[model samples]
Target: MTNKLISLLDYENKAKQLLPKDTWQFISGGALDETTVLRNRLAINQRLLQPKRFQHAGFVDVSTKVLGSIIQLPVMISPAGSQSLAHDQAEEATASASSRVSTVMVVGTAASRKLETVRKVSNGLLWFQLYHHGTALTEMLIRRAEIAGYQALCVTVDVPYTITAEKDLRNHWKLPYGTEMANFTCDEAGLGIKSNTADARQYRRPPHVPVTWDTLEWIRSLTTLPIVIKGIMRADDAVGCVERGVQGVIVSNHGGRQLDGQASTIEVLPEIVRAVGQKCEVFVDGGFRRGIDVLKAVALGAKAVLIARPVFHGLAVAGDVGVEHVLTILRNELYEAMALCGVNTLAEVDRDLIYNCPSTAPL
Candidate 1:
């Protein structure tokens, strides 16, 4: 009844209480000691915002270009699997929510519904997330995604090997009934099952070949959809992706879901941008909870930002409406920050608006 549903902070408070404890831990917890997870927030806090003087103090814009497409805002939905856990709508509901907000939503390969169904619900731009189980299946999904009106192919390359979260192990977390891997029926071993338990807290590694830079050439042979390489953190990898003729690259740490000790995406954005900022559109994801956070990433040179976890929280609390509210909060916060910082557009926001803070700032 209060103003609690109006902002992201209040939504966060509600989602924690609404979702199952194990689900909450799995969605929010990072791998290992979660050093990178905690550090992600700290890294953003350390960024010092530099304010400009009274110059052209009017008419601010939030719209920006990403991968040759003009998006309403610099925020995007990072491709994440297991949305069915949060709502009955799952991918379809989440996609529709993104449409309501005019933001981009990247659909995961492991979604409960296939890309064809997802495109039908989403009103805004769409990008299909690929975690290729094999070439035949990969080409099948890619072609289907393109056929279904997807604008791009966002290939996730970070999780070749899956790590079972201990939290899930403790809670016996497993995929509920009616949800199955939509892309392939089974792994390379001919085992139709993906998880060892009801919650799928643990999974055996399938024999899919390691994803490498050369895989780009293989992908190029399959479809014409713009290929966006996600889950890159190192500058060299960013440069390599550009050189490989990738249309876009998302600098991410897998939402702190994979490795735990790596540097936060914000801490590495500047260097990655320097390395490949000019070659292609460089986007970033990780610890993007506020408008100031998005501003920090942009000022550091990210073309845009992607979000995970929060979207799930929104879905958990209020389905599509909750997702809409979550994105609106971030978008509204970003606009306010831009106005206060005296920037009229994304390009106007440069490194001048941010510097590393001495304390809590990464050393």
Candidate 2:
């Protein structure tokens, strides 16, 4: 079954056909205008892999460690909310497939399945993502994840507002009945969100709360888990995370669903990586649909890459089987790219393996 998927786009096409209209938009649509969404892919395609020929590179080893946890490949599943929209099995199926491939699955705060439930089913690394709904809710999730034995905490910092996607508005999309924010569905969780802070009111839509740097520090005080900040696009933010003792920083634009017209994650990764230096591990996501894209990110100094929509595409198409197939395809492609670039190990993959190659027609 895995052999049937020769590329990530195949999974996407199948997913589009299999999923309901509303569910598809929720997964595929970006923020207003979607310029940043398209820009993410364009920035990636513009970078060319400068493969080295006849260097006699041997067997490629794609395995690498993320904050001391070794994964089979440099690819990991990014956090996506309510995966139940993609498959009946939901996050459980995705977790099982991620474990089967020996990689990490950063469970979303809005996952349809509870974190513990997903953890119970996964034999692989699990990291819980948080949206900083508020002090109590944030603490509750951190404590629960710690109790459940999650390895790390990834705090999403970009979505200071709930900018409803344009496609969702057009389709009048809503979560199907029965699916819930498994972590916060209970009343005891306190609605799982708060109004945006005063400073962020201008940037946020109604009912969306902003988590400030002070809030980040507050979060850091509550748990001993290694905290990684997601949704960062600026070099200064990366530097600040390092200075404040963050364990990692994920260079992302919230998959272009938070801010429209912001620079793509790929476009800003190099600067952030250079700014952060070796103070902390740097990861990236957005517009990563191929093994070559993975290689391009690695060469630009990303420790590893996280993918959200592609995993959702696979889940919608063929459940766990599609997910495993998608991961395997990317791994195989990364292996091939490494061999062609005269690199036998992840360490050998650096800026030297890439060059600027402009593209005219990105669509």
Question: Against the true structure, whose lDDT is highest?
Answer: 2
Off by over 4 Å in 1: 1-3, 185-208, 356-363
* Model 1 vs. true fold: TM: 0.91
lDDT of 1 by residue, 233-290 (tens): 8889878777777888898888778887898888888888888888888899987899
> Cα lDDT of all candidates, in order?
0.80, 0.85
Tens-digit lDDT track of model 2 for 171-241: 88766655657676543344543223333232121243587878878888888899999988899988888
Residue 231 displacement in candidate 1 (angstroms): 0.9
lDDT of 1: 0.80
TM-score of each: 0.91, 0.92
Which has the greatest TM-score? 2
In candidate 1, how many Å is residue 355 off? 2.7
